[model samples]
Target: MSVSTLVPAAWWARLGQARRRTFLGYLFLSPWLVGLLAFTLFPILAVFGLGFMEYGIFGRPTWVGLENYRDILTNDRLFLTTLGNTLYFVALSVPLSTVIGFLLAVALNTRLIGQTLFRTAFYVPSIVPQVAAVLLFVWLFHPQIGLINFALDLLGLEGPNWLGRPQWAKPAIVIMGLWGVGGGMIIYLAGLQSIPQHLYEAAEIDGATEMRRFLMITIPLMTPTLFYNLIIGIIGSFQVFVTAYVATQGGPLNSTLFYVLYLYRYGFEEFRLGYASALAWILFLLVLALTVVVFRSSSSWVYYESGGER
Candidate 1:
């Protein structure tokens, strides 16, 4: 009674409500903050610091100034080759995923029999373990006895040697990557569902054709989702490693040598930790620049229902 009554009523109320909520909020967020500090933020800062030094895992890091960046930009032919390959992959895969995912989402949104079954069937491939998926695709794309070539044979056509040929290797990887388009399709489906149905109904009342309704109403409204997926797809495409690592090993003359795989080779395999850190920083900057450009351009197209601007 003495201690509680000594506190002002207004201050007690503030402590009971606002301070309690603030404490609870921080308490709930503590784990994530701890993880960010211990793992993410520390590693990122360490990598950035290491980029300026000559460090191997076994020894202490020595300061080397901008030599790593200079060598990567000017002297490293493989770096340029990998960067180009990464850009090529991003250019093809991102758009293909976006278009295919949008189409699949649109199809799923229709009133069709067994729609739920179809959605499940499409999404299941995305959840398959990466190693298993790569192995399955290797068998499927096998030049001799695979199902894909068998189908081509049945249709009186020759199947290209996918992983064995330089020109076809990256495309084979792209095809493998597309198997996970179902994940993007699910996101697009969510966006499609969130769109107001009344807009479509109004368009129907205005005598708009199906195609017109889709073009004028659906596409514009889905731009935010499209933008989000595009950025993610771009980043994923640049970091492509698994398929090439497991199936192709960036082989058939390094046709599928993606940026992250190249970085991994230097960091872990070749033991050039400092150079690898530089590569990582370069990749980060490239992604950041691309993201910034996309965000800047979003004002032209992307629309939000609430704020009316991206």
Candidate 2:
């Protein structure tokens, strides 16, 4: 046999040894892989397949080509409205939340008395179960009887009928989103911790003002976490449903009609599975494209400690 044949055998032997050493790695990860395949990948493919059909739960799906997409694109009024509403929410909430989270992280990362407690307090809302949080916000935003209005009264400011008025309902959701930005805050906190103390010391030695230090050192180093939160927060905000559904029921004349809320209405309420599937696919495509753009742009700004000497 040629020497190449012996080389192949040697490589195969190495591969076998590696696999033997890491045998339990696959077994340990089997449950997650199975879940990804069965629940995630399978359902994604199924939804894509369904998007091209008119599917009744009990009947065979009738192939409809691009009819569902055309319907939404050409004639669906609520589709466009909900899409705009979602985009508006993302535009307003994502940046504000990201900035607020980063600022809070910067503040919380400092060495101060009861700092851990402050961090926990900020993070508390994030761990609240979704349904419970939504329901709690329902009472908190009640037009006249809510704590929000109560606080407004204390401040001599009128709290608009939050859930009652369409114009105000979306703003209410945005405010609610800010309250639960703890997830982003925690991520920023982690990123802040990862930032080398020497950078701040260097900035201090250079007589950089606090604001200048933050603008120059803190933000640049925190770009990765900021990018991560921006991407995730935007995606989550785009498909916002729980707040609209629980708080407004997509009411106040569909002012709070979110894209995912509308999708859920079609899928569950109207049983337009195919159309909902199409919406899902469209949302997936939009998020995917946006994430790609963000990642591509990140290289221009994301700092990497300049080879550990930043």
Candidate 3:
């Protein structure tokens, strides 16, 4: 057949430039696409598959179907305990972090002497290496010689064993988590700075009290940032491991046994790869569900200048 018989010359000529551009775009994106598939997508799929099997480090993977999940749900008391501990940590840490971060941002937004220094001081702790911070806290939390106990003694009050007592272990972790609130504070400060100054001026002209303006204008506009911090806090709090692993190692009657720490013990220490994969999948679903719920609720609470509620 003639070269031009199957397709019209005009149509082929018109398609050539668009096709080349598309190919070039994809060619540039190929590296990222390959990396995503190789490192991210493949591992996720492999883990999901492994979740259905029984693969200890020493043996071949055997198809166990739902056995891992059944055991976790029915037989594993530690699973429930870890899950409850994680929820407790998340519940306490997220709200406290959000509120404290937001307040710090608000306070920092105002003009003050040495404002930059104060902001930097508040934020520096958030950038410290997690292990280092945990180790430092381990000293500060010592029952007898720690700085915290020394301060309590100065106040003529006794300090309980912070990390040694099961009742205080989780709260100690929560207090440690607060040390990183400066990251969220930065986000909140950015949100606060982004709010139009004219709105506050107008509110003031309308005889709105400082509290009223803050309640109506500041909070409503900052809800999006609040929602963002809430989601991040929940996700991060659920996966708390390094602090517990380094400081407590789920110690003092397993009070600090968080979900990810438990998963790490199974996957690495215990060499139960398949069971660990199942645990990972469950955590993924739990975080996903919570994220979805937050997103759903956001429309009611999160305000945007363009759309009001979104």
Number of backbone-clashing residue pairs for each candidate, in the order shown: 0, 0, 0
User: Per-residue lDDT for 1-310 in model 3, tens only?
Assistant: 6435655777656777778568557767999999999999999999999999999889699999999999999999999999999999999999998989999999999988998999999999999999999999889989999998899999998988999999999999999989999999999999999999999999999999999999999999898888887887888888999999999999989999999999999999999999999999999999999999999998888888876633
Error of 1 at 277 (Å): 0.3
> Which candidate achieves the best TM-score against the true structure?
3
Candidate 2 per-residue C-alpha lDDT over 124-186 given as tens digits, one digit per residue, 9 for 90 to 100: 998888878888888999877999999999999998888888889888889888888888899
The TM-score values for the models, in the order shown, are: 0.92, 0.88, 0.93
Tens-digit per-residue lDDT, 1-310, candidate 1: 4434655667656686677678667867999999999999998999898899998878889999999999999999999889988998888899998999899999999998999999998999999999899999999999999898899999999999989998898888899989989999999999999989999999999999999999999999999999999888877787889888999888888898999999999999999899999999999999999999998999889988778733
Total backbone collisions, model 2 = 0
The C-alpha stretches of model 3 lying farther than 4 A from their native spots are 1-15, 308-310
> RMSD (Cα, Å) of candidate 2?
5.5
Report how far residue 65 has shifted in candidate 2, in Å.
0.9
The true-versus-predicted C-alpha distance at residue 2 of model 2, in Å, is 36
Q: Cα RMSD to native, each candidate?
A: 3.8, 5.5, 4.8
| Pairs of colliding residues, candidate 2 | none
